[model samples]
Target: MKDRATVVCVRDNRILLVARERSRWALPGGRICRDETPNEAALRELSEETTLAPIELTYLFQFTGFNTLHHVFFADVAHHARVQPSNEIAKCRWFVPVKIATLSASIPTREIVELFFRYIRTLESDNVHRISQQAERVSL
Candidate 1:
């Protein structure tokens, strides 16, 4: 399986998706280069395809698709960041997560997006629990 670096750029509850000519909407990323790490590939592909440098990028997880192993990364970008489609990208847009189901997207893209949102929800839940515990301890 080919190893690819996929980036998830989310802002204001919307995820950025890019499309090539006559292709389905997908995240901005591409295959890992021979001399570069996954992190490097993620950033490079994001910049080449979207022309937007993320404020921060973090490794998220690895996903196995039918013929590719995706090294997923999360990118933090400003809410007002403008994206210009570059290189092989034909168009770029931000879409609400709930609207993804209605769009024509690659299976891996759809699955990765769902997974990312679920992961975020889990993180938020954990933070709330931790805060609640801290409050209880302080009151005691």
Candidate 2:
């Protein structure tokens, strides 16, 4: 499978979506470079496209679709990046989840984007359960 990466940087509950120079709306990233790890490639592409380094970046998962293997990542930045598309992207801008549905995203791209929200919901639920358990243990 082809190796690609989608770099998602969130600021103010919105996601930074990069419009490729000649393609539709997507994240600020590209295909994996030779001998480059997913984190390395993500950092490089995010910097190249947005000119901002993330304070924290983590791998979300690997999405295999559209004849390519996509290494997806989520980043939390201290500041909202003012992005100017580099050689790969034509434009970049932050977007809320609602706006995402209206954008011109690829089929697989939207699927992955939606997955993040689901992940967040699941994570929050799990955290709540863990906290409750911890409270019970403390009271015991």
Best by TM-score: 1
Query: How do the predictions measure up, each by TM-score?
Result: 0.97, 0.91
Per-residue lDDT of 1-140 in model 1, one digit per residue for the tens?
89999999987878999999999999889999899999999999999999999899999899999999999999998777889999999999999998998899999999999999899899999999999999999999
lDDT of each: 0.94, 0.82
lDDT of 1 at 43: 94
RMSD of 2: 1.5
TM-score result, candidate 1: 0.97
Q: Residue 29 CA error for candidate 2 (Å)?
A: 1.2
Range of the 10 consecutive residues with the lowest summed lDDT in candidate 2: 80-89
The window of 10 residues in a row where model 1 has the poorest summed lDDT is 75-84
